[model samples]
Target: MTLKAGSILTGTIVNITNFGAFVEVDGKTGLVHISEVADSFVKDIHDHLKEKDKVKVKVLSVDDNGKISLSIKQAIDHKKSVKPIEIDWEKKNTQNAVNFEDKLSRFLKDSEEKFQDLKRHQDSRTRGYKKNTSH
Candidate 1:
């Protein structure tokens, strides 16, 4: 298969280095830079990939010298975008309503308890002041 820019291809990790991993695809090898290995920061490439591991890579560019630039993260993102999101509308709506009601009731109960505590504190202070002034 001809490897072209933006094309996603499956390849084997032939070698791993401090800077990147070399992947072999269709008898040709391409470099997946450490930064292109994953979506997040890759402090160590070995943490995410191993030699002989199969990976999907999106071709970033093909140089005149046949050097190919690839990105695993972009390949994953492309796959994710191609999939359709599934949701049960009825189930989600009922669950959200129950959660909202539970949260609101808990908040109201806590507010009322705090208000009562403050009222009691104020009443006690008023009584103490009255006793002192009458003396």
Candidate 2:
């Protein structure tokens, strides 16, 4: 089976590393990056995958050096099919209407004040140097 970009391929997990997993498919081995392993953060790769485990992965890219990039999350159909709940924004917050520009300006002023306060505290902590008598 010739591996191409966007192609779904079944392969065996040959090795696992801190960065990714090496999978062999159609006589060619590819890497599935940690981010591509699943839809969520993978603290430990061994928790999600193991050697000799058969996995269906989607080919993301075929680099010029012939390295194949794969994504197991993309291969699996995990899209939400349920309809989202629609919210009536205007009715929900009619009484508490606030201008975004005003809020942003206030936030910037607050941030600047806090930054100045921190700078002053830091400068005070530094020992005051005496002026040199010989110049």
Q: Which ten residues in a row have the lowest lDDT in candidate 2?
A: 92-101
TM per candidate comes to: 0.59, 0.58
Clashing pairs in 2: none
Residue 70 local lDDT, model 2: 92
Give a tens-digit lDDT track for model 2, residues 1-135: 678899998999999999989999899999999999988899999999999999999999998999999999999865664367898866755444467667888999999999999999988977586657997
lDDT against the true structure, per candidate, is 0.91, 0.90
Candidate 1: 10-residue stretch with minimal lDDT: 126-135
* lDDT of model number 1: 0.91
Report how far residue 92 has shifted in candidate 2, in Å. Answer: 21
How many residue pairs collide in each prediction? Answer: 0, 0
